[model samples]
Target chain A: MTVLATPQPTISASETGTETVPLLEVENLSTEFATHAGTLRAVDGVSMSMTAGEVLGIVGESGSGKSVTALSILGLIRAPGRVSGGSIRFQNHGELLTKSASEMRKIRGDMISMIFQEPMTSLNPVFRVGWQIAEALRLHRNMSKAEATERAAELLERVGIASPRKRVSEFPHQLSGGMRQRVMIAMAMACAPKLLLADEPTTALDVTVQAQILDLMVQLKEEDGAAVMLITHDLGVIAEMAQKVAVMYAGVVMEEADVGELFDEPLHPYTQGLLNSIPRGHSRGSALKAIPGIVPNLLHLPTGCRFRDRCPAAHAPCGKAEPPLQRMPDSARKVRCWLHHPEPPK
Target chain B: MRNYLLKRLAQTIPVLFGISVLVFSMLHLAPGDPADLLLGPDATPEAVAELRSDMGLDRPLVVQYGAWAGRILQGDFGRSVVLNRAVLPEILKRFKNTAILTAGALVFAVIFGIGIGILAAVFHQTAFDSTAMLVALAGLSMPTFFTGIAGILIFAMGMQVLPSSGMYPARGGDFFDLLRHLVMPAITLGAVSAAILARMTRSAMLEVIQQDFIRTARAKGVSERGVVWVHALRNAAITIVTVLGMQIGYLLGGSVITEAVFSWPGLGQMMVRAIQARDYPTVQGGVLLIAMSFVFINLAVDLIYAWIDPRIRYS
Candidate 1:
């Protein structure tokens, strides 16, 4: 690992006014799904920016829309889902999303690639491992069959698969979960995409395998200079891999800061609840710290702030209107909570 | 896989035996006299009695069953009293017609059923999906006879497009002519299977698409087509094949109304004619063939189960 002056670069040198042009700028993205009860706001007003070479971790619980955010970026959200309001702008890359099906198809595996949570089910069992890896290469790169096959084998080896030449001929069911995940990684890396979105890539693996996969991703990110959007509930993985962190609750971002600063000091009550809920080594004898109450349903989220119902610090004003991301006085860290910053005197 | 095949084959014996016994007994008890029908209404009593004795229909039921069983064991399905020759040869000749019809129907059904299934599933809940499913529902509700008549009227009567029915031309032996003759009957037989399969495919695809891996495929930036075809469709294979296999058995066993309406020379038509003439031997032979085909089709399905799903391995 190469160490720079500061692990979290406020803004990289040789780039004047670069902050004005985020590599990816998602502004007030709200995705809704029509349901029996009401419209569910799966990704509500989630806005975040990522610079090139930045690994941004969006951490949240199961229903917190972290995965949905990653999926929205790829334009993979299916019907019954509407991207109601928002603009996702990419600076050098054409546009964040194309409503045109054919254009979306082109960018999917070529420009922006993703790895899913489960390696076992993600792969087509009937297909050979090498063929699946070659598919993306053949589709996106216009590579010949022979060239794609050869490169697929090489990719398997690059992702640390042993005897890739022989293993490539085997079907997915023949490989173990960890090996399958490695194959997933190989497939994602086939086109050398600029942004690699990994949504719980290591969640289905054992602890040891998870560490290995995480390390491999970090190594690949550094080597390829690919920005990674890591979505997971594991703060440890976030701490290890992410340069920046965004804590989400009920489809809204609760806080955004440099990973170091966020880990050192989490401002929003929801963020603090999540950090406290982690099973620490010192809390072995005692009960694990779990945040009281469940995540509110997106169909009927509280009017003001989504987390207010579960937040211990919620006040009467919290029920009136939602809080927007406001910078802290001492640092560049942004928190979206009324407790941290009161509304201007009316 | 070899072991699975051997196991399946071994398991078919009891099934075939049971089917033979049931068919033989039912044919024996059927309310008709072959001798009376063969000799005609004007024949004298002694002459009819002599014909019955000659055909061994005068023997006790058990003895007649025993004789039939013994002959079947020696690969003899006995003589068709009406044809006055070996039952096997007559049935086999008729069977060729049925086989052609079944094969054509199967080809038509599998292609159209699976095609519509994939289309409906991929376009789930859309206008196309809804329209396809609605057509399937209509197909299921309309009886085979109605569909057969509708097909003949539309294609044969109104359009003046092609030959309406029958197995071959009057001149005979031309493959293209036989295929052309087969189209209407095959369509009539295949329609219901296609409808059933479309519904099955829709439900199966719906279930498979909900699986976690489908989401994984979509997130991997796989195209919508790839997600539905390569991932969801393959995952739904076992169920789809199961419905198709059952349809295959149904086609082979009978296409009665379709055969009658189209005048296709299938076993179903032969069975009806045999029953009307009280040709006991021919009826028994037809029933036995259908039973055996049903058993074999079921066995084929069980054997293919392992091939389609790698999770099932014969111990």
Candidate 2:
């Protein structure tokens, strides 16, 4: 893997003796979906925290419940899917899980916002791009139509769209995919939200456009100083953008560490497998190390560690019981494997 | 836009010509002669022959069609053989009455259909949605004429609340009174169309509600009402509008049966009377007018589609 050493501050103000709190704190979050077979536990007791101005990258394969965790935080899960248990507390906003629907409405788009994958489908096709952005301003900022429209054009320009005044009147279908994503970014940044949840924002774009979008996100993050939770399966994105990383597998966090520490000495077997699977320049001709087996079905997950089926280092004790996420001694890293447990099984 | 409209208008000529030819031939092939029907059975054969010859029925079919077509081109619909009045004036008089009933029924259909449809969609799979769908299904299965008869039996006979037949009561009341007389027939005529509109609206709303744009709207902190009505409903409108257009054409064409059941003095009833009397010119005129109205309504619908969807532009 090509590791880009991007400088990011890992410590928040609270750690520097200030009384500032973490930007977001999630505890024991569980989400379920009702199916004909039974209740499928899609997200099983996952928890993480982020501080102001931090970029926390969550890396996981498909069906690992990364997106569900994001949706659960935003309270966007709909019928057949639900957040069964959890306490999500923001710095200024109280427990989000306990907030009324209307209270959540006020917080969303104003205090926190989201940018989704597939910009082509994320925007309302019938509406003008400028109008869409202006809608957020009008709703949250209480700006007049003219003022909101003017600000929308300014936002479009800020997101590097050329001739934003002209682009404002155009509908989404008339714009290119890259332009649409820029428009989405402009909309998400409309109210200067304190936190932004980006779910694979560049997965659908071309590589060149993806680079540009990432650069734009970095620039916006610096300018606004808003905390972001970036969710993706691409390890390269985590190396380039994240200060903290969380490795998730089958709805459980397999490892959580500072990005540098996690890359240098990945403690969990699943995290080690993930890092080794990445092809390096020196090993171009050699067979890449691929993780064995797929993610277990959430409805019938094994009784022990969820990754035991695919772990190359599994032994007799691996299947005996589930492993708890425990902090390592003399390190700010956590791993959910028996090998890292204080007393390893004999 | 102008060019497209002109082209659409030009296309109607062929349609109207085909209709005229079809109506003329069908009336000619039917086993009835206008002169014989007009004349008494006791009349002599010489008298019947003189009457047919005077009325130009003795001419060849092609010649008679040519004469009728030429007069139509000059804005003359010939004269009604049985009524002994100009065909154009009599048809216009009846068309006005049918237009009133049709318009009333259409208004009722749109308001109730769209309302019920939005309600059902917002409620989705809830009990309200199921019950609304069931009522719509019932409406779809029952024919308008059957509903008209049933309406008359209940409203007119049992409750004695409404006048069962005619455009106005025998006492000849005012406009509101005419509207009162119009209620049962309009509801009967509008029921099936309303059901169709509701179902279309519900399906369209369901499809639109699942779109990513709806999710985006909800994420923007827009209320559920705004998400459902403003964001989802507008996207779903193209299908609903198309269905409404089709229903409008059906209403205009199908109102004849409703008109007949209620004894309303509309072109439908007049056409039925003309067909029974073997009045070829009057029948031809009425059918032509109805066909033209249908074509025009479809044209209006096309224009409406352009208005509702920004992607659809007339060049």
Candidate 3:
């Protein structure tokens, strides 16, 4: 557990006045994917925001729609999928982002960057890694081929790869998995985008490499002054890097708060279940505390709280209607469980 | 990859030899000897015997096969007993016609198939996509001869847009005229090829559009077209190429009924005439060319794999 004991001194709140608005503001975002069976609401009414240079972690089990939420913010959901309702307000140097696909394309890699989960498949095999990175710069900026190539080498070096010049000429298949991911990061950082979307950036790597990559991202994010939306299933990574934590379960946000607050007092039963599910060293020999049931099917979600079926703290009222994500009176935390309060107001 | 290619090339020799052997034996074993067929049923025994000896059909089976095989090795596919000339040259003339038709049809198939496939996959279940897929399904169900007839009826007889049949003008003026004559048959052939290829492309594109990289591309803010063309299409390319390669083979195999109906003098029509006349040399020459062309196309596809995907290497 590499959770920080004290908040980093660099981003002290007093230094930058609260007047500085958040770089990205996602509000009541819901996305559904069409299937033969029926429409599946993969991301249901999720909301979050990130200030410049801030790191936000979205943690959940598989199928919790954490990834979908991140993708929805970027308008990346494809056919059979559509963003039913929501607004993703991105303020990059105060320029708004409501535009057509072509207009959005101009801003995508230029002003905002994204790193995918699997580096092996993300990078196109037919092209050189340098070409991919150079393409981002060339498409967004009006740089000549020669200049983009030179800048690509510099980027590879910035990402800490050795022999950037030689490596630039090689295809993606010639590189190792970690190196490919580094190349992806380098590409994302090429234009110095203000917001970086890292969707499970390190989940595919080995444990040690995962830490190294996360550290590299943090270091780069500090230098670039870019906000990051870190989507992952690993709570350890979230504990280590995220300033804010968002917990999701079965296509809805279960709990969200400051990292320290969420860890110290996990209000939602699903969040508590997820934290308890992590295997401790001493508890290895014994049966770990597992969540009793699997996530309910998103297409046929339960009527009330989606997690009520698996939640140990469910009451009779939970079966009647879905719970709303409401704030706790004493704290800044927002939770979506009825157990935290006596009952839902009529 | 280079080593792998060299190995495949080395293996193709045995494959070609085996195909030739099987084709020659089958043609020879079929009823009616070439010499007898040429002399006809009303011919005297002396004339028939003279024809058999002249045609080298009087020799032992092993000796005849050896001489014919030796000539083939020397790039001489033996003489057509009826035509009184080398079978290779005669076959080559018709082979050129088939080759042109195949080339035309292939270009049409690839362009239309890839275009429609990408559009349908991108639009998915929209009316446009449904209509495109529906057209593809109709194309799939219609046989080649039916397509040719429909093409002739609409374009030639009804619309008066193009000529109905034949590969070239009887006088054989310019090469362009020959191409102009081939358009209808080529489109008829291409329609069938396009049907299967379009479905394959749509399915392949569907599978690829779901990959994380395509999502990453979209997340990076690449436009819908860019996400599809640059990311999804490129990833789906290997599968598309595989289908395209197979379709090319089908096209190159030539449409027999289409060729016959249109009076297009391709290898297929030539082979039909040779078979009906029991011209062993001509039939062997036609079958051998078709097999060889198919092998060459497959080899070309193998070479293309390395270009399309850097993961594949000849060494």
Candidate 4:
């Protein structure tokens, strides 16, 4: 797909201050699960960085290791699954991957928080939504019960819930899906963390409510000045909200670029296929081009380039070895494709 | 809540009525005559006839049931033919003993049952989990009577640490002595039910701990202890409460065997003695009271559900 690069305003930390560091730097992270089938690599050598208040969207199909990366950052991977290799460096907190579980607990809802996908099943059914939000405040802020409860109601009002007082006393099952998602957002933003991990937060909501939740998240990020790692399979969400986009397939990122550049001139064939598959205004009456083949099983991934089996540009060299994630000349964009990095071995 | 209680109480009338009819009819259908038992083996035929008429045993089954029901409505359970005492007072005394035993057994069952269950669930797939579950399986397989006898042999006969039978010393022992006598029988009766409860609690906890809300709690920075106990256990309590209610009912009814083995002077032993002696009044009275308590215990359990989870509205 040949397309023009769209120029968009950059929101890099370097532009703000010469000495400012990125809020989160995840370097060469790998997460694996030991299964009876074998050791399955859910996330393999994934690397990315985000600055404060910036939005980085990781778009991929199901089972593409997006969620695992998010969980690894929080040190939440339970038994059988573990972070085998990684360095997660937070701005204020040193390498998080080395922190003890208790230390991680202190950072989790304080400096970095996460909002999960299914709002319906995410809230404790036995508790009032207000109490749930207040619990985080009480735990991290050491607020009095009365103070936390009042703040919880105010947060509910802030998130656009009506009759916040009455709603505060109601159980989670009493709320609709959209309202529950709003409650989740309110809770995550309670302590105003430096980074927020929203894992398909709007995936379970209705279409109309999806936009509202996204709008609320954008507003919260703006207010809190928190960097967001928004993981989703929806390209539309990436185009609308993310400043940077990372296209992941088979547990590896194929392309990472500014959102405008990625959408305008997607470098990888998989990224191009994703863009083409979206039914645009001009392609209304035509058939959409779908990427051939399904995502490879992580247990038995293809030997060389993971995407070679599904790439139309695949040739002899593509099967020889995996391509490194190389930066484009004079640009911040990065791509992992032999087409862009074709050079004879030394 | 008041309305709910009133409605639940109203619903029990038909149940008690149904239980009374079944107990009364079954006692009558059994082969044996209260008049013969009261008169003894050497009594003349004319004496037996006189006594049967005097006691209203010569009347039709319907007439006898109607007379019994009318007296029961007046808060009178009639007199026991063999014991020669008021059935209500006799039942009340025996019921107190049974209640004490049942409460002790329930406490034993719940504490150990829920404790072992949570441990097994938290340490799932470990040796402790496996061993605890194996013990539970063994407990479930053994009958209460068999357990009671084995308990007597081990603690009473072998170790000589407790009495083999009875609620207390005949010479008015202290509370500690009574407790010593109660320990063996209570554990014997509670073991099987505790096993059932432990299995229920384990499964319920496993299910609750896997729910997405638990992950949410942990994500909220709640401690692991808080996640399991406050978040998961409360959700699991709904099922645990249900099993507890059913097991309590079973314990009350099944205490008969344990009481007989221990000679604890509870309603179970009284019922057995009454049935053998053809004292129809006492037997009917004991069964009816047990059934009523079972119904009330269930009602309390339903109320507890609302307490544990506010989302459950009884209305």
For all candidates in order, state the fraction of native interface contacts they contain. Answer: 0.42, 0.60, 0.65, 0.68
lDDT values for all models? 0.83, 0.88, 0.83, 0.89
Q: Determine which window of 10 residues in candidate 1 chain A has minimal summed lDDT.
A: A11-20
Query: How much is the lDDT of residue A229 in candidate 4?
Result: 96
DockQ-sorted candidate list, best first: 4, 2, 3, 1
What is candidate 4's TM-score for chain B alone? 0.91
Q: What digit string (tens of lDDT, one per residue) describes model 4 on residues B267-291?
A: 9999988878778888888888898
Better of 1 and 4 by lDDT: 4
Cα misplacement distance, residue B75 of candidate 1 (Å): 4.9
User: On a 0 to 100 scale, what is the lDDT of residue B162 in model 2?
Assistant: 94
Cα lDDT tens digits, model 3, B1-315, are: 678688778878988888878877875778776666777789998998898888677888879778878889899987786787999989999888888888888888889888899989988889989999999999989988888888889988998978898866778758788777888888888997888888999999999887766665665556677778887787788888888888888887756777887988888888888877777788888888889888888888877776777777723
TM-score of chain A of each: 0.93, 0.94, 0.92, 0.94
Interface RMSD of 2: 0.7
Of models 2 and 3, which has the larger DockQ?
2
**TM-score of each model, paired residue for residue:** 0.86, 0.91, 0.88, 0.94
Clashing pairs in 2: none
Which residue pairs in candidate 4 have backbone atoms (N, alpha carbon, C) closer than 3 angstroms, thus clashing?
Answer: none
Cα lDDT tens digits, model 4, A138-201, are 9899999999999999999999999999999888988999999999999998898989999999
lDDT, residue A46, candidate 4: 96
Docking class of 3: acceptable
Q: Candidate 1, residues A1-346: lDDT per residue as tens digits?
A: 3355247576454354445567788989988888878889999899998877789999999989888888888887777887888888766765666557777677777777899998988887766889888988888888999999999999999899999999888888889999999999988888888788899999999999999999989888877777899999999999999999999888889899999999888899988988888888987888776888999978777888778888989888788888888888878789998887757212
